[model samples]
Target: MGTSINDHVDRRTFLKYGGAASISAIFAGCTDNQSTDETTNESGTDSPDSTESDGGSTSNGDDEATEFNYVTTVTPSSIDPMKGSDNLETLLLHNVYDPLLYYTDGTPPELQSWLATNYSVSDDGQTYTFELRSDATFHNGDQVTASDVKYSVQRMMDMQNGFSWMWEGVLSPENVEVVDEKTVRMTTNDVYAPFLYTLPFLYIVNQDQVEANANSDGQFGEHGDYGTEWLEANDAGSGPYQLASRERKREIVLEKNDDWWREFPHGQDGYEVVSAEMVQESATAAGRMREGAEMADQWLPLQTYNDLANEDGVRVHAKATFNPFYVYMHTQREPLDDVHVRRAISYAFDYDAALTDVMSGDSDHLQGPLPGAMWSHTDDLETYGQDLEQAQAELEQSEYTASDIDLEYTYVSGLTVEQNMGLLLQSNIQELGGSLSVNKAPWSNITEMTTSKESTPDMLAVYLSFSYADPDTFLYPAWHSNSHGSWTSASWYQNDEVDDLLTEARRTVSQEDRVPIYEQAQRIIAEDAPALFVMNQATRNALSTDVQGFKDNGITGYRQTFHRYYQG
Candidate 1:
């Protein structure tokens, strides 16, 4: 059995392959924290057997259940596809909107034809032409047209936010043209290798609906807000589901699109309805999971999952993902401004302790700037380990004295693992004769602070996952100089050479040709030590045994496409 990084490796295969933490370590954590009085099922008393498929299978319409319920930490930040970028928002938008292409579940996830049946690139590699799926229809029952494709691309370029970075330099609005009712053409400034990967994010919208609902007195002059306000509560998409209702910070619902262009797998109709309950507390979500909830929150405490593992009808899935947890240093800020100081901080921290104590052996050591799972990742880059002598040596190379190295470290509030990791770093930094303060802030506040170089903390922890399945998805947004304002590049680290390398690499379409450029760039960025590459995270989820066909698609937001699951 392969790892779940490729969903071809199912949950049963993962357990058979021992993809989770060591059983002794997991059970040890459970014994220490799980209460003795928790409920159990007599039928579910048997030990988990790898042969019993935890992934869902097709049903013969015997079950009466229609709605698939899920627990989440928060409501989507926004429903407007061009405005929201967080996990919840992406999850919601991914289902509500269908993109030009879709990624089939795998290690190097392949781009499956979605809205566009086929596409071709021009000889110069500057232009792409896509043939639309003729039968595709929006929730409103309107046939999707080539003009809608043109408008979606233009709308993203005009909004200048939420994934606009992918096309900012490579494509212009004038380059998008409706060749006919079934064909649309896009021309880039130069050759862009990851353009196909990025297409999965270019969610198509009903152009006429958006134009009719646009607010006359708002932003995006002439486009008039581009239906941003209207889209906050409604969807104008051709996806497999339609928005039923939404209540910010509380709940959102989606109903199956009866007019969907494609039939679901195994003669099943897919989920008729999907409900997401916004519960902030992990314990509360875990309780719901134990009480027969189909899906649990993604970031629940490790102990919660360990306890749930013993429960009946519940399958806990822990899969190593593309997400790289980072401890970012504000490169433009003092002390951290020195590359030697940054390197010192990286060396002083204990990566082994982070895996053993903080992450509880659920994660893999990150190779460098990119997660090692990525095909373009290079093993040649230097990695830091806990060595106070080396740390002190690197610190001495900096102009600042040990006493002047007081720093502040921040992590997301309510995340136990992040808080514990912060404490571990605090203790390590204190040992080096420097004072360090650990702070916790809400995710909203952290994102707000990242808007400026001065506001971003001396050091902060966050996990970055790819929106697309290409190396550029990890490299360009998180490291490029042009992406400074976003939370992904909050470190404010910039290099003309690195930027040139990334820019040139993206313009080179061939994967073989791009490898050397990406390698050199990763080597440079790793040496700079802008952020401490902590670990590649393993996403842990408690799923109901009744739910099958759940795939770890290797992309963050698109993992839970409810339409793919079998209720029975």
Candidate 2:
């Protein structure tokens, strides 16, 4: 018998590159109509018990709502399911699209069925078969079937962009097969342990709609543009909401999908409409929240959240996330290529100032690559702290002198916290006799610059997030040699020993076997100091007190699924 395994954007310049710098929220409460079946899969990674939802607090009753207003700083680059990879794009596409499985809370194991009722893994841990939910239908009212699932996988693999890195070497289009109208099977080339964790990223699309809308640009061969052009502003999904309109740099409006597969579990009369307004300035977003905006984006500083909470109608919700804010050093670049230099820079970072001053003590200091909240995070791992003496000592060990250290740090523009972080690093590095120049770039330009080694800056400030809560989600993609050229791996660090350890961890299905392997990798990576281990973020969002049933959806980059929000 097969066992069950459950799991859980950008555009243009973002497309040519892979992922983006994400500083992205959580969902709680209310179970949808989910299958109760407990099918066993071939022994794979252990998963949490299947839950409709782990259960969140719900309101007694709610009045009919006109719309739920949400304010954010960044703009979604593309709505195409396979094209966009940033938090802004995810905040939009996640509502407009449905993944096979949903990561509702903390880790990959805390998954609930979405489009797929349940899935089974083969004996060798290479093949997975999913049973499609019959009631699931795309926005155009077409029934979702096995073919759509297959096509979605094929398209994701074909584009080879965005979150495609999740499946890069493990899966291919030829590996996905439609067994029947409702059953789809996928076979990986290896026993990829994180395979299950990558499912929530496979946002299904209407195969027919894509083909009908495809143009002959030949970007994707016979698939033409594969509906990328059409999907840029439009959505072809079976999610809880449908894209009503997308205004560039303004807002993306979404209306509830009445025909959605799952009904609201709580006494939640979900919002009628959702307006994701793009408000770049934190003060403006806070102002709008005071003026009756239901929710504010996650980018606001800690003080802003506290101020909003003091208001009569506003409350703050915070959840510790696995998203680690990083100061990635280009390991392939000169000065930074030296491990001593990297370690020296890491020692010079002001961790206390970052946590207390810049982040306002909201986030936990990260131990290593993995956040402390993660299951297998190395608790005893020695992490960096502000020690100028140690910094100078490490610098002395480097081939280059302190005077030779001239570096540039780049961060996303308009983010007050990141700017402060850059300034703090600049000051600390200066104390070590190194000059560090701080610069800001728009999110789009940052994504474009990080695409290649030549254009990438010596140091970059970005928050790296995982779609699913697995060690591989952080280790493999963020540090592996093959994963370079993307924002997450912009550090460009490569270690054969660490790579072999991570590879073994991926192949090892059992959590017990994988933990030590992961820990070893963490230790090696931390010693290398390719990136400054700043802190794991605690995301705080302001919401109107009337907005009830809000839960932290575990994955970073993905915001709260608006379907759970209703005015009480």
Candidate 3:
């Protein structure tokens, strides 16, 4: 899918083309001559003065431009804030929806009040009281009140889909109480340490607008569909942007909300519109960027980063992130049910070669699910490195012989890096007298298959980023037995000891006390070998040189502030 003219270039040709001379030659006569007056501040930050112009002049000198472009590989299935599990959807939803608390990206991540003006927690830590801002209003100009917050939480639980697990044991409908128009109180069954951090995922929606657009034939038919059908292409929250138009998997357009409650950090006259198109292929996205296509602002892929590193008017930003990629082994399936078989497959993987040759040395091989930056991570666990003799030995101990089974490996289609990793895995397994059949599908189809235990493949390669900074973000949904049928737990591997450890760890408030409990859980899970640790991914984005105010949060990776971006 990524095939292009650049794909046929050899290693020597790539290096030659990536030089400064080649870059200058490629854009000699096509460079824009108009100069911008905006300059960086004393602290070396891209902070333009208020008197600066709205948009920069292009080669054609058009002065009325008010739109910014973005490109992505996958299209969002639904814009419903409560029904999405991917990062791309989160980026789009954050622009049109406001959560109770907002996580700001910085040296140390902090949660700031957004819809909620203030909040308090009881000494026992089971009850939380929040004060809503009186000035906050939805897109329809409806005042946001305590009742809207209560209804939004209840609606999410009633739908019984998408991120409901975030509040599974912490909250319920009966525990929510509206004290007044601007005050609300919520009580939990026990002391959940991650409760405050998890509030960022609970987006507040206008109850009146949702109820008026409700349909009876939706996923949740009993509650008049809870506006599930209408929210797919619409927005009802109070944020900086509102939905303008959408064509499902093709493109989405957003217009600035002039009456937004918060002022733009840069200025009031930032880009008036933002549009994102689904390119699906890395080569096509890169080609568009080089040709100065109006729809090309960002591109994804390491190969694209290499190809465009020296191009004029292009910048590449890379940073270590909390996301980790792994190959999940479906323990509920036949041959994978044997722990020996899973361990053997894990040992046969050449992680170093995959990171160097396939990934272009842009990623770090992970020790376990938790990244080293997290507090609870440890280096005490055993890692399964490439050892063909050890792999063969483990295979001999399994119930079935090497020829007894043919493993089915699946990965996201249109991703060249993933396809290469899958092929490398097949070769490694073949060396140990095992067979692997590689399969590929679109991300949307793979996500659908992961919802059911029977539909999940024997092995699937996927990437996961933390929803919160705590260790529970990596442990609870992944290793807990209750998450068996969910897409987060495609491995379908469960252990009672690991479940009890994770449950206790979440309730433990003191970081000192929780460390040992999480360490014990990580050790146990590593010994069980439910999934093979692949690599810790780095957030990489190729953008036009004029793009500014794009900060990558170590905790939330791609959650960016669109209102802060100005072309000049």
CA RMSD for every model?
Answer: 7.4, 7.4, 9.5
- Candidate 3 off by > 4 Å: 1-65, 219-222, 293-299, 557-559
Q: Could you tell me which 10 consecutive residues in candidate 2 have the lowest summed lDDT?
A: 9-18
Report the candidate with higher lDDT, 2 versus 3: 2
Q: Encode model 3's per-residue lDDT on 395-506: one tens digit a residue.
A: 8999977786589889776666667778899999888788999998876787788889989988888776467657787778888986666667889988999988988887
Q: What are the Cα lDDT values of the candidates?
A: 0.75, 0.75, 0.71
Residues 420-463 of candidate 1 have per-residue lDDT tens digits of 77888988988887888999877667767887887888888887
Question: Model 3: how far is 176 from its true place, Å?
Answer: 1.4
Candidate 2: tens digits of C-alpha lDDT, residues 273-349: 88989876788998999999998877775566656666778877655545577889999988999999999988898
Off by over 4 Å in 1: 1-65, 106-108, 266-269
**TM-score of every candidate:** 0.88, 0.87, 0.87
Q: Per-residue error at 355 for model 2, in Å?
A: 2.6
Positional deviation of residue 404's Cα in model 2 after best superposition, in angstroms = 2.5
